[model samples]
Target: MKILFNKPYKSGNELKYIADSIESGKISGDGIYTKKCHDFLENKFGYNKALLTTSCTDALEMAAILIDVKPGDEVIMPSYTFVSTANAFVLRGAKLVFADSKKDHPGIDEEAIETLITSKTKAIVPVHYAGVACDMDKIMELAKNYDLFVIEDAAQAIDSYYLGKDGLKKPLGSIGHLAAFSFHETKNIISGEGGMLVVNDEKFLKRAEIIREKGTNRSAFFRGEIDKYGWVDVGSSFLPSDIIAAYLYAQLESLEFIQDRRKSIWNRYDNAFRGVLDSKHDITLPFIPSHATNNAHMYYLVCSSIDERKKLLAYLKSNGILAVFHYLSLHESKFFNGKHEGLNLKESDRYTNCLVRLPLFVELGEQEQDFIIKHINEFYKKK
Candidate 1:
């Protein structure tokens, strides 16, 4: 009974679509498959414009570029997120004001964001951790009052929804001025290494295309909007190949099936662990707020302490299960510690040291999952 951390799931048409893309002789970006993908996302999600990128990191970089992030500009984000969330702005010479996570969940604290905003603050990047929504209403109000850009890091938020104060539910990516989503192998939808830049505000559409096409109006040239295209703006080669889009399209077509299974797996884990593990007073399960809809992207538990988490992770691995820990708090990381200004991010640090992710892929079988649950139970029982 050997179970790894993640296994990429394939829809029936992935290879077929990849073959189709190769046969079309335009394996480059924004080909037939690419157009199909763009259409699918825009039509389904109601995003103003969705551009496929080589990776989510590239999409975030593109968002930073679109907003004109410059030196000394401050961007606020959770210290508990992946480096890419901070690195995108850091590459643009912006100062990162690391925010703390909520005590109940790993999402950024909406209450703390207002205090972090200063005269130099330019953007607020709220990461929807584990497909759970952050307090977007508060964050959006703050963004409006302060005139700051909102970039939703929806890397794990696909198929997730956030209910607003107006009682309307909006897709996570659609609410922000700009957003980035990942289709990496580890995510629910995947294309090996692929991503999408969702431009909710239409102002960035044309420029977003130009930036994605290596600072050229190549997208316009291809669309017959212009006779020729050349260097136009500061940008990069962010667009992904049509092959990647093709594979992603196959996955998108079966999005419901993938989400259904993932949610089922997530619910099973929640039901199994909620009362059982939580009753022991040494572990805590994920907490979902009423305003957010779960996409079940991941299932992680917070142990009582760093030592307990490490020992439990070791115990699981020794039993042929590959449970894993998540990100370290970026503020406390060696690269940023000196520059972090020494703000106390207790909740972020707690998640960094204590959180452990269990395997929750689409193909993880009932028996295999049971084995994993049994091992986890055994590990805790002995302690």
Candidate 2:
């Protein structure tokens, strides 16, 4: 049987809700279904405000505008993150200052952030890689001292929490000044190609709406808080149709089921590989810090080197299972070669070369997973 790397799962109510949204006659954004999605996210995540967007890239762009990222302003972020994280700021003419990943994990190194901050530094974008929380307390402290804004790239971090110094657990998106979440098919919860921009700072609340609504006070006008909506600030057509929200609401309603199944699949991979492969120095499993919670976004392994990873990937494919590597270090990309100062982002490059993600979707059955596990173990055994 040919196994795919990722297959989007559908909750039973998705079509029914989408049909209901169509019948409502208001298929535009911010209609009943959109309101329900916003309410669900805001209430469930304790975010001050949440606005749905066409995609996570759009949400990040909205965030860049909200923070007033000016030309020549600098934003610090990990080199291992998705292009959307950097492109958002670049679109606003902000210079990207890339940071390295931690030695043990793919998340940004919190200790190295302070060293990168300059007078031009205006914001810090920390991506919660693999739905594992970053060192937020340290990140927040650094931001506070530097008077910088924090935008959580929570594209994979749905239903994840970070334990603060006070021993209280706060949601990942809620901790940042602003956060962007993805609902792409590969993510834990999907709305095809959807995203949400979460506003934690009350100051950006009004502007967030305006930016998502194509630079208008249209949201306030709808609430009768304004006489008529018109141009207000820099914005775009960031909002998604209510039909997308309706489909997302169905997934949100079944969040528990999805989470549980995904977690089980993640654990199954972990348990299958822990003693079998982790004993060798050439391979490493994921490391979860004490302060972070896992949301089972993806399961990846780090091989000894790029050559070994390529062989392993080929092996998986030959066995009718598909495994893939993740992001290339952004600093080394062709687009940033001359722009990015020559800095040794060793960990980011290592992840780019050696990490391989296995299939871990909600619909992946146990037998199929066991077949995957068997082939992986067989490959390693021969190696």
Give lDDT: candidate 2, residue 243.
Answer: 95
* Local accuracy by lDDT, each model: 0.94, 0.94
lDDT of 2 by residue, 313-342 (tens): 999999899999999999999998788874
Q: How good is model 2 by TM-score?
A: 0.99
| TM-score, every prediction | 0.99, 0.99
Across 145-187, the per-residue lDDT of candidate 1 in tens digits comes to: 9999999999999989999999999988999999999999999
What 10-residue stretch in candidate 2 is worst by lDDT?
Answer: 275-284
Give the residue spans of candidate 2 off by over 4 A. Answer: none
Model 1 clash number: 0
* Predicted candidate 2, C-alpha RMSD: 0.8
TM-score of 1: 0.99
Candidate 1 Cα misplacement greater than 4 A, ranges: none
